[model samples]
Target: MNTRSTSTFGHVALIVAHCAGMVDLVALPVWVGTLIQHYRLDPQQAGGLVTLFLIGAVLSSVFLASRFQRVKGRWVAAGGYAIAATCFGVLSQPLDVTTMAVLHAAGGLAAGAALSATHGTIARSANPHLKFAIVGVGLGVFAVLFLGTSPKAIAAAGGYMLFAIFGGVMLLAALVCAIGFPDPEREATDRQGAPVAAIPRAVWFGILGISAMALVQSMTFSFLERVGNDRGFSLNAITGVLVVLGFVNLLPAALAAFFEKRWSARSVLMVGPVLQALLAATIMMAPGFYAYAAAASVFAAVMIFTHTFAFGLMARLEPSGRAMAATPAMLMVGAAIGPVLGGTLVKTAGYGSLGLAALLIGSLAVLCMSRLPGHAPSSLAQEPA
Candidate 1:
């Protein structure tokens, strides 16, 4: 095929891989609720299980990201998802908590490796922000379908069906990637053919900012269903909120893409955490259905919109793609703590405490974002070789 055709095909593969790898965005609520209701685990235990998965992802992504230049993206993407699919398939069987925990961690590790490869390739593309937004739009579409149907299906077929669906999605991603995942051009090298300089301190702070926001996102999101159910909202009502959330999810990435040149990335980054904290507060503390539904519906959009800009900024700051390759670690490191921390807070201090936690964490996010340099240096902005 021609270069244009190959590039288009690679974009498609990246979108599919992104949607498949980031299953937590669409599935976390159901995943946690299923464990609580069907598997008979407490909030902390259920959250801890999810935390283990995020921790595994973080560990693997951190390990692979630094070596992104040397690794083959196509094979890594194909192999990782295939292994993750197997882990999820096994998880579908009736198993003890210990076995399930091991499977969850293993699956997360495999999936994170694939995500690292996928994101590294995107960072190396001609337009990292636009590319990330395109994939985000794809994920939003997946969220709509997954949210609209998965609940009723799980209700009918049992919680194990969730794992089955997860396995199926991962398997599909593996197949697609194996057939056509693109190998982007490698990062720019020095005269000695060495990789570029280390990632800037400012970029690290930007990453930390995104990670903090992710923690807040996951903490509140993991309990969205439970919060509604506990407040006596009907299943249909909660599901309606989720469906609306999914539809809402479709807009942010497109909006981010549109606003890319218009808005300052730093300004967007600064506003995101504040909006995230406020929405999270409303979702957790609202006494009525409408208030909770409204807040919950648009909550995920904040992170989606903000992260697009942050992803672009990081790509600019560290053009080698090493920092972007660490995307899973940046996202999941905070996420690993969120569920368990949220659960502990809910169990001890009640849901209102989540609002307080969000405030504190969001402040830290703002602080980190504030530290980022206004622009990438000339040296860091050059295209990778």
Candidate 2:
């Protein structure tokens, strides 16, 4: 019954719960592909599903966490998992597009609340960068397993059934871990449920930086295969590049976690954006197979470094945790907008447009990082919230 005693279990449980919720966005391509085939729909029509999901996710992340952040953790976790499982089950049933959209939206709401609660808890850890890295690793492992099992599930039952089954499993696991979470009241110290505009100006800049980073990432990554083709890469070569890039993604988080004490968060924050711009330029200029492969690998590594630190910054920015709660929403919102932006660029010029766009976006992120309260030398890892 003691909150302090549950620290170890609470940490692990938060990681597990966050990963389960994150899988939806992390594996968007697979889910969207399956949906397109199942419904005989165009990419645009299927894409609307993602938009609705983000809308639900953003709404709940901001609304619920802001109001009830002081509520008990177990209640939030159990309630969220229960809601997600129920929605996924209903989502598997035969329904019109309108009906399906509503269920998906409900599922997103549950996921956002669950993710925010867990992530906000982790944000308070003694070493948030390390905890965030663990999140990245957990996601990587889940991605491999999800992809491996998904085909068989899809073949035997259907894509819809896969969601129901996974939802059930996640629900059970989350329920078991319900008692492990530490006190939400302590994790999220509400400023009497403060209004949105009450957030510090510096924190707003950090949020904007994170959103811009996500925008550049999704925009480039979404059409990477097409970019490879445009660069005259063979299909197998492109697959090889991405396969290696996948493994490369795991390293940065591990490295960042290990080096947490050694590096200043501000140093990492500033350096990361520059590296991102450089890597994006490499893919643009080199125009060779090996260059693309190398750039992709480096980009993956740099992202985890930046993403983890930026996330930690938000946690420190406001102990009320409202800013931290919006992370999932910001990421999804940026991702939802990226394709349209990238698509416009591609139509106007070529794949080179992505490089130019990244250059501009990365610059904006750097400028935003400058405004974060912790950007000063000594305040590197100190809590600014």
Candidate 3:
């Protein structure tokens, strides 16, 4: 096939892989809830399943993507999905809680590899500035759908059957990836395969900004549904909020890509934290479904903006697509860490702690953004990576 043909196929496969990730992520809370009930486990024991999944993701980013250079992107993603599906199927079987936890861990390990490979694919195929938002939108779209809709279906049909359906989805997604996605970089580019380093000192602050933005945004996402429920919001209202927020999340990304020609990446990232803090504070004070939904929309937009900018900077710092792509891995680590910290804060201080924590994290990010070195102005939507 021609270059355009190859790029098209690659893009399609990458998007498919991203969509599959959303399916897996959305299905998790349901599965975890089932495990807790089925095994008569404590919250801590059930929580360990999520922890293992995240740990697997973090480890894959740091260890698998960072060090391994020989593996092809297509196979890594497909293989991981296959493994995850197989594990989930086994987990659905009648088993002890300990056995189920082991299966969950194995699935998580596969998901880690799948996650990194998907990032590498998207980074290689698209421009850096748009990578996160584009991927975020794809993820948010299906996530909103599944997380928003699937729980009721599972409740009506039977929870165990959901795992089988999810496993089938994984198999379909993996097959699509294996057959369609090409190598991340053409074979000839091996010597220069997206070389990246720890982001440069000049951009350290920008990195911090993105990380902080992710922390706050993730905290909101983790708890907002519960908060909405507490506020007596109906299921439809909750679903509306998620759908709206998902749509809102794409706006900043689309705007950033459209204006990257005019705006410095630093300038774009610098706008996220304050927006997040204001919205978070508003939610704390108002706590209505409408107010909370509006807050979520704006927060998602700003977070997308900050993420795209910082990822763009990372790509600029590491021209090697592969190396620059690892920024997602790093962000994944921060994301994994944020929820645990947030849970602790909420447990000790009550739900109101979410507002305070958001303020702190957002403030730290703003401070970091203020100190980042400026890049030369350019119209190029894609960063060097």
Candidate 4:
């Protein structure tokens, strides 16, 4: 194939990999009410399901990070999706709420595997810097916001069936990617199945950035959904808010090409939390719906920019294939923690507290961020300079 054609195919693989990672969380909001009604679960208990998923993810990342280093990237990706797919199929059955939560947790374990493995795959591929950005856009923006935000048939009798379909598609995509995409084993590791030893300080910083952002996001997004409902927003209106939020998220990444040249990665990482605190304050002070929407939009913009820029910065820090491959696994640590913190907060405090808590957390994250080592300009940033 021509270079352009190869690049196009590679981009397709990245998007597919991202979509697989995305299905784990995107449909969550849509299922929230249905899970409550069907399972007869209280708000706190229903929220626990998400917490359980996080627990499974955290444990999996801890244990499997090294083992994944020993295995072929394709196999890891395949196993994660297969397990997730099977769990989703089980969930489609008429089980008690407890059973459903357990099944979801099982799926979470699978998702953790897929997520770690796909990151490895992307990192080892040719021109991985571009691939990382693509993953951010495809998974972070399009798959997450578009497919995840789409209203599912959660309230319908065949809701479980819909979930099953969702799982099946993810599984199918994983399988196809595994089969069609080239193996990353050659690039990801040296002989004897060990990744290289060059660890970049900026990678650690990236992990810190990801962890902080995920926590604030979980707290705020979960809170916004619940509080908006409390404030008498219709489900349709809530959905509209989510859609707008997703679109707004695309803004920062869209302008990343411009910002990276002018600003340091540290600067980009710092913008998100500061903006989020401002937005959270706005939401707290504003009394009208339009004001709330505007706040949400600004928050989304900051988050997207932060996540994309930080991820790109991390990829630049690590030059070895496998070390870079492990970056996402490290980053997932934050992802796992975020939802659990948010769920616990919601259980204790009212939804209003979510924003307030995030504001404080964001402030602290900014302080911690100053201690992290800085990264040099990414290749993208160097181009056209």
Candidate 5:
């Protein structure tokens, strides 16, 4: 293939990765309500089912990251979709709670393989940061649209049918994967012909920072609705706030990209967590819906902006794609642990636990990020040309 063809393929892979990331192969809160209603699970049990999915994803991501070049990239990615599709197909059947958890865990493992492949493609891109931001925007758009539509569909079709529908979505992704990724032999030649670059020391810190960031976000996100209700907001109001967040989530790519050159990645990485913690505080302080709405909008924008830099920085940390390969694994690892922590904190600390958790977690993230470049540069004004 020529340069243009390779670039086109890479772009398609990025979009596919974005979609793979967006596809909730496991269905979180949406499935939470269904699991609770149908399976007679308590809130924590339903949430644990979500964590099971992440646990599987984390495990698979680690496994795939090591053998990324050894196998057929196309088949690995396509097969992951196929596997998730099969899991979803089985899940659509009537089953006991134990069976359902087992099936969801299977699906999560499949999703993680595809996610690692897709993120690897992004990491290998020429402009990884920009690509990462675009991927985030794509995910945000898809999440909003899916979240907006899925609730009603879950209401109408119920959980089993919805799982089947997602299975169909994965099947479509498999078709795209066939076209996007190179065949095994071609991939082997490319890997041998064009070697991946050396890794920077800073990449390791970026990895730790991204993982911690995920823990902070998921810890609160999984239980955000309960927190809102505890603060006196109605369920309908909280749903409305999320929908608005979906819309505003589109801002990250454009906003973050605009500032990335001017602001320097280091300072953005440091301050991003602080802003996230502040947003958590806003949710705690603002009891009224409108105030919460204001906070949520800004929060969505800031969170996306931060995530763009985090993923992009990791991609840039190593041209060898090792850092990027590990990206999804770290993310899922944090996500897997988040619910456990959130469950514990919400129980012990009350509605304000998310704020406290974010504060503490964000501080940890900040500390991890400080080791990277741009954090303590003299000033944007003082930099040499």
Candidate 6:
């Protein structure tokens, strides 16, 4: 294919891969709820299952990210999703908790590898921020469809259907990526025999900042449905809130794209965690249904918006794409801690403790953001690879 045609196809593949691989963002509520309601697990156990999945993702991403240039992105993206599909399919079968936990971890490993390939390719694109935002928009649309339909499907056919749906989506992504995942142009350091420059310290801070925000996001989001349910909201009402949340999700990435130049990325990064903490606090502590629903709906937007900027910044900081290749590690490391931590807080201290936790974590995120340099250093920019 011509370069233009190849780039177009790759973009589409990335979008699909993102939606499939980040299914946790949309499915966590139903996922945790199903384990609690159907499998009769407590909140802590349900959250622990999700935590195992994220921990596996973190491990896989960290391992593969460093090898990004050596490995073939297309093969990794396709094979990972293919394996993840099988794992999810097997998870649909009736199994003991131990078996199910193992499957979740395995599936997460596969999915995380695929996502590492996806983000690495995007980082090498002409405009990483714009490309990432475009993919984020695609994820938002997928979230709308998944959130709107999956709950009802699970209700009708049992919780097993949720895993079936997840398997199907991963299978489809695998097929598309196999056909069209584009090869990124190698950096000069790779083309020659020279070593790539080390990732900047600022980039590490950006990654940590984004991860902290993600921790707050998953910690609160994983329990969104249960919080409402415990507060006596009807199933339809909570589902409706989720659907609205998906729609709200549609705007943040686009807005981030528009503001990429107009707004300071560092400022956005700092403000994001504060907004997230406030929203989470409201979601956790609000007594009225409307108040809780309002906060829950906009919560994801904060992470999406901030992460878009952070992704772009890291791409600039490390032109070789290794930093961005660790996208799954940056995202899932903190995410790995969130569900279990949230569950522990809830199990011991009630939902109000989640609000307190968000405040503390958000403050840490802000501190990390504060440590970032205002821009990528000139020496790093001029350095080969």
User: lDDT (CA) for every model shown?
Assistant: 0.89, 0.66, 0.62, 0.60, 0.69, 0.88
Candidate 6 per-residue C-alpha lDDT over 330-377 given as tens digits, one digit per residue, 9 for 90 to 100:
999988899999999999999999999999999999999998765556
How many backbone overlaps does candidate 3 show? 4
Off by over 4 Å in 4: 1-7, 31-33, 67-69, 125-127, 140-149, 156-162, 185-195, 280-286, 298-301, 321-332, 377-385
TM-score of each predicted structure versus truth: 0.96, 0.79, 0.82, 0.83, 0.85, 0.96
Model 5 stretches astray by more than 4 angstroms: 1-13, 24-34, 37-39, 182-199, 229-235, 298-300, 375-385
Q: Kindly indicate the candidate among 1 and 3 with the higher TM-score.
A: 1
Q: Is candidate 1 or 4 superior in TM-score?
A: 1
**Deviation of model 6 at 19, angstroms:** 1.1
Cα lDDT of model 4 by residue, 196-245, tens digit: 66565656655665667666765455446556666777777766776776
- Give the runs in model 2 whose Cα sits over 4 Å from its true position: 1-6, 36-39, 93-95, 147-173, 176-179, 184-198, 223-246, 277-300, 339-355, 373-385
Q: Residue 304 error for model 6, in Å?
A: 0.3
In candidate 6, stretches whose alpha carbon ends up further than 4 angstroms from where it belongs are 1-6, 185-188, 377-385
lDDT of 1 by residue, 138-173 (tens): 999999999999888998999999999999999999
Clashes of 1: 1
lDDT of prediction 3: 0.62
Model 1 TM-score is 0.96
* Span of 10 residues, lowest total lDDT, candidate 4: 376-385
Give per-model CA RMSD. Answer: 2.3, 4.5, 4.0, 4.1, 4.7, 2.5
Candidate 2 on 126-235: residue-level lDDT in tens?
A: 55556778877766666556644554566568667666765775686468557676654234333446353466778788878877777777666655655665677875
Q: For residue 4, give model 4's deviation from the true position in Å.
A: 12
TM-score of predicted model 5?
0.85
